[model samples]
Target chain A: MFSAMIKKELLLVFRDKHALMALFVLPAVFILIMSVAMRDQFSSKNLEFSLFVKDLDKTSMSQEIIKLITNDKHLVQIKEKGDAQFFIVIPENYEQNSNEILKLNVQKSLKENEIEVFKSLLSEHILKARFHYISQSIELYSGKASKILANLEISSDKLYKVKYKNSKKLPNATQQSVPAWIVFGMFFIIIPMSTIYINERKQNTLMRLNSMNVSVFAMTFTKSIPYFLINQVQVWIMIGVGVFLVPLFDTPALAINGSVLAILEIATGLSLAAIGISTLIAVSASSSEQATTIGGILNLLLGAVGGVMVPKFIMPESMQTIAEYSPMAWGLDGFLDIFLSGANTQDVFIDFIKLFVFGLVCLGISMIILQIRIKKGL
Target chain B: MIKISNVTKTYGAKKALDNLSLEIKEGSIFGLLGVNGAGKTTLLSILNALVEMDSGEVEIFGHSLSKEKTKIKSLSSIIPQHLAFYENLSVGENLDFFAKIQKASQEDYDKAVSVNALKELMKQKASTLSGGQKRRLNIAIGLLNNPKVIYFDEPTVGIDPKSRNEILDSIKNYKNFGITVVYTSHYMNEIEKICDEVAIISEGKLVEQNTLENLFLSKDNKSVNIEVVYSNILKELNLKLLDETNIEVPKEQLCELLATLEEKNIMIKKIDYGSTNLEKYFLKRTGVEDV
Candidate 1:
């Protein structure tokens, strides 16, 4: 009998061409578009930063400062011998008139005032070079604003150095947002699945089926099958594409096996959630337009909360905690564990379990709602 | 045999069915007749176990529709007005799916309803079939389980005359053994032709139930209307006919009598007979005509 229901469901899935498009074909297309759109986001890129330094004093202190800045990560120093856009020179004497005048010049080329700060830092550094060019500024000098101002009028011999280590790593913003899109694509496909099934119920097809021997749960679950299959395929393709495309920026290919498993588990769980959501929409909506509107609003809400549109890392602490309840968040978290962290099955097992429970609860609620609707002739 | 005892269903302030009770004997073709809002479908839904009545128990072959719903399901089949099969599948596939639902085994399925019988046309999708063909397939699906009790709800609603007869013939031949048939329709002729007994419901209440011959006969069997050109002579003739024994003039004739007289040398333009079909019985009982 179960097999019979499944067979009938498959037959029905195939019968409606529009449903097929909404489920499988749309999900696949969505994953493709999203992966392409976000291709440069998560992938690592060969970074290059434009550096500008201004120095008035030609002291060894200024030269050493320039060397430290040049040695910084992926930075190229572009300083002029004269009044370059950024330049610094150390004075010969420091006792009389110890104050240094800082000038930030642009060849009508500089876009922002960071060059102004760059010139100020170099002038201060030349003042410090008049004394001992100390590397550890933290131990020798106080970083207090008042003390720095007082030191500006004192002899260069009292000048203490403030310097940073050359080695530093910076993450690309585009890379951080890329993975979110993959999950968003999954969410994008899922919303329609929810809406279409709701539409079916609004049209009284669900009641018509109930008038036959089909069970409420059977109808609800069968409606999810096409979506479930499509979502799984979508998860697979998006993960695969994400993996392949990430390497374009020299990032490691997203770990495949773990990511795939986690995605599959979350997809199953989310599919149940989708079923529940659709059932609620079907029952609660008095009109098809109302159902679509409510379903659309819900999709957007879930998508945003689930971190499909925002990176979970950057979300506020409370929002991050709240995201745990979102089906998309669970899926995205599972995906992150596998692709972002290279986790194994055991690593993602908890996320899978959480998602599974969420799916089951939602599905159960949906079935109950559907039963009421059926009995009530909705 | 099927027995419905004190079944009642209510929707808020409105009573969809009020203590509706009836018994349908085995091997008998029962016609359930009613107006649009007569609660006929609600009663059927209860018997089919598609819904639980507010208060009542329905027994089919000594099994309660609620407690022994599975058994009832296996024993009964329903042919709804709308087609419910997968239109994407071939005829054979559709049948196969329904057959599997009933747990019909390989040999029994072959003998009962051959899957291969639809083989020549197996490649064609069900959506491509005409309306009549689609209806036939729907009926075929119902027959797949070889149920003893079949419920046909407006089975002939939108079909052409030829296909209508074909379905009727199928229903006629459906009772080779002692299989019960519950046929519901608004068409009086269908009830008159195929039913052994008919039940009429009005406004959520059962107005009458018995063999069609008995109900029509006991109710005077003289429910007919005749229309004629409005003239003093024809109106007088109609008045004289109304005065005949074994006849009753409903309220409409009294209201039309005065206006019907002023004209002269009136010819009978047309004659219409609104004989007491089930709809009349419903109107008489419910006191509301639109429903």
Candidate 2:
């Protein structure tokens, strides 16, 4: 009986072209458009800050320091004055006098955060050059290179390294935009699901089913199965768009670095959670109009608060705290953990559990509402 | 067979079914007649176990409805007033889908299709079918379980005359297969034509219950309308006037009163006998003329 009900629901949904478009096409288009449109904001590798170098020392060591500064990925070299945001001055005999510190003069027009980043990058290179000069002097004076290196033993890895497992580079626009919009699209299943449910009630199909030996649980589950499957399909379609379609516009393709099974597991959990929420809205609302309206608005709000509209990293701390309570946030985080952070199944285990629990809770609430409505013959 | 006793259902402050009691024998066509808010729907819902009763004992096929809900549901099918099938699915798919839900065998599906004469339109979507064809499909779905009893709520509400007749014919044919049918409709003529027995409810209470023969045959329940040239004779005779010149007289009292009227030399232009209709009986029992 349950299978038959699900089949009927699937048939009805497949027959609705409008619902199909909303489920599959809308998210793909949005992801593609947003990824291409905001590609620069996501990829910061190409950004460069102008830096003027005044090499007064003119020694080989000073030239070496200049080479290090010019090799910086984020800084572009400027020869003349007044042509850069900041100027680096290597004072006379700066390399000979190892205790002397290089001066960095900046324009007042630079923003405070920009200035900080600029100063940090320049200071890192200068400190590396000084360490190199000291290592060379020690090798020269001791005349035993192996002993001097072993005693110093300093390396760049000691300065900064990730201790956790499965860490990767940050995501570009396509990776973040794909999953966020997919989550948004998955929750929008509520509109169509609620509309179908309300139509069943209005047309007396629910009463008919009741008279046909179908329990409320059976009906709700059967009705929810189709939308859950549709959500999974939506997820895959969006993933496909991110992998194949987004890169066509010259933006970097979304890469999934973690285990594929982990991503699929999270997708399943998120689908269940989304469909459960849709079922609740479908059964609880008074009319189709109210159901669709409330479902759409609730999904949009969840999308906003859950970091789908904007990255949680940029949101206010209080709002970020609130985002933790959203199931969408859990789902988006799980996807990002796999796509951006190279996390495996165990890495996102907590997110998957939270999503599954949230789905069960919503299903429980829907059942309670349905049972009460049936008892009261509403 | 179905029996309902002391069934009372209340919706907030309004009483939808007030101490209602009824019995329907097997293989009988029973008519439930009432106006819009006369609790016809509430009664049907309770009988089918779709709605709970605050106080009642309902037994279907000798099984308690409250305790054996699944059994009762399997034994009965309700054709709702509105279209209940998915419009997007074809007629065949709808029938097959409902048949599977009811656990009906392939033979049962074939039998339903043949009985309803829906063979050619099996591939047509329900939304594309005419009103009467859709009504037929609805009945076919109700018959999927091969239920012993069927509850029909306003089956032929808005349809062409030909389709209405076809549906009426189909309903009447249910008795040939020994299926008990509980039919409700606003069209009194349809009730008078198809029902073996009738029950009239008003204000959530049963106002009258009788077989068609007894309901119309009882002399006190029947009346004759007499039309005279003017109202002077009716005033002299102290007979209540139904209109300007028409007076409603008891069927049994008509002959003696007409003889006395002839003795009084009153001219009788026309004497119209009120037809035995469920409408008249409903009006007389409920004290409301519209329904």
Candidate 3:
């Protein structure tokens, strides 16, 4: 019996051309446009730093240092030495005289914090080279030098090391935009769901169903199942667009590194949350016009507050705190964990629970409201 | 069989159903007649268990509606005034859905479709059907459950004559099948034609309730109106002055009065006879002619 109800709902939804467009076509198009537009903001390939080098030592050691700096893919060597954000000069006799402390001159067009980072890297490389020179000279000078150097226990690992846990790179534009917009589009299901519910009430189908011994919960669940399936399909279509279609327009391809199970879990959670919210909107609205209006506005509000329209990291701190309360935020985070953060099922478990709980709460509230309306004959 | 007593429903300060009560017998076509906001729909809603009634006990088929709502609901079906089927779905799909909800078997579904003559439009979307076809489909859905009792709230409000007659005929056939039908309509002729028993409600009160034959018999006097070009000639006869040039006389006295008017050289332009109708009974009982 329940399956039949769900089948009826699916037929109604699939036959509605407007609903089909809202479910599949609009989200795909929005994902493609937004992901492509924001590609440069998150792609690492565009990162480059210009460095100007003035080597006066004329020694192989100073040349080797320059070679090391230029070898970095992110740093580009400039032929117009003076016209660079960073200028480095190696003093004469810096590498020839072992007792002479090296004096490296540096100049920059900007005094930003990033220049400090560059300076630190240069200093670390220079210090490593000096230590190596000292060790080699000592080895050549005396047999005891090897024993002394071994006792010193000089190791680069000990000198410079940093550790990170689950420190994958942040999500690129395409990766973040795809899931965020997918969630945004999925919640828009409220419009169609609410409209359908309103239509049923107007047509007396609900009253007829009530007369047939169908419970309010049964009707709501049956109506939501089809849309939930539609939402899941919507997630896959957006992901496909991000992975395959967006790259055709010269945008970075979204990489899906997480396990399929983790992605499916997140999608399920998101679908439930969207369906729950749509059910609430469906039962609460007095008419289809009101439902559609309220659903559209609410979808936009949730998208804005939940970091779908703007990245939460860039939002104001207070807004970010509030975004944590949004189901969309939880859903977007779960997707990001799998798509960009390389998280497994266990990694997104909290987000999954949150989304599912939110969905259940919404569904519960909708049922309660429906029950009250039924009892009151509203 | 359905029984409702002292059922009152209020919305804010307005009383939709005030101390309303009625009993419907099995295998009978009962007509509920009322004006708009006369609590006809509210009464139907309560009987169908769609709404709660305050200070009342309703029993359907010997089951308390409040205590055994599920049982009562299972036995009843509502064909509301509006088109309730999903427009996007085919007629077959709509019927199948209702049948599934009612837990009807395949055979029952086939019977319902065949009975309603909707087999030819099974594949057509409900939105594409003509008004008459849509009404048939609505009735077909109501019958999907093979319900013991059916409440049709203005089922034939807006339809062509052919469709209207077809629906009216189908409703009458329900009696032969021993299915209790509670029908409500604004059309007086429909009630007079289909209902074995009729009840008229006004201002949330039952003005009259009885068998159709008894109600018709209760009104003993039928009158005829005579319109004449000349005025005030009927003063000598036992007649009621309707206007300066028209007078209404009892049907039994009509021949004598017409002969008197002819003898008095009063040229009659038009003569009208009052027909025995539920409208007249309703107007007489409720003292409101608008309905």
Who wins the DockQ comparison? 3
- List residue ranges in candidate 3 displaced over 4 A: A51-66, A80-111, A117-169, A249-252, A314-319, B105-111, B219-221, B224-247, B254-277
* B13-36 per-residue lDDT for model 2 (tens digits): 999999989999899999999888
For A258-283, candidate 3 gives per-residue lDDT tens digits of 98899899988988899898899889
Error of 2 at B88 (Å): 1.7
TM-score of each: 0.74, 0.87, 0.85
Q: Which of candidates 2 and 3 reaches a greater TM-score?
A: 2
What is the C-alpha local distance difference test score of each model?
0.62, 0.86, 0.83
* Alpha carbon deviation, residue A374, candidate 3 (Å): 1.9
**lDDT, residue A38, model 1:** 55
Best by lDDT: 2
In angstroms, the error of model 1 at B122 is 5.1
lDDT of candidate 2 at residue A375, scale 0 to 100:
63
Candidate 3 residue A96 C-alpha distance from true site, Å = 8.6
**Candidate 2 off by > 4 Å:** A54-62, A78-83, A87-109, A125-158, A162-169, B220-277
The interface RMSD values of the models, given in order, are 3.5, 1.1, 1.1
Q: Output the number of the TM-score-best candidate.
A: 2
Model 1: per-residue Cα lDDT at residue B291: 42
The full ranking of all candidates by TM-score, starting with the best, is 2, 3, 1
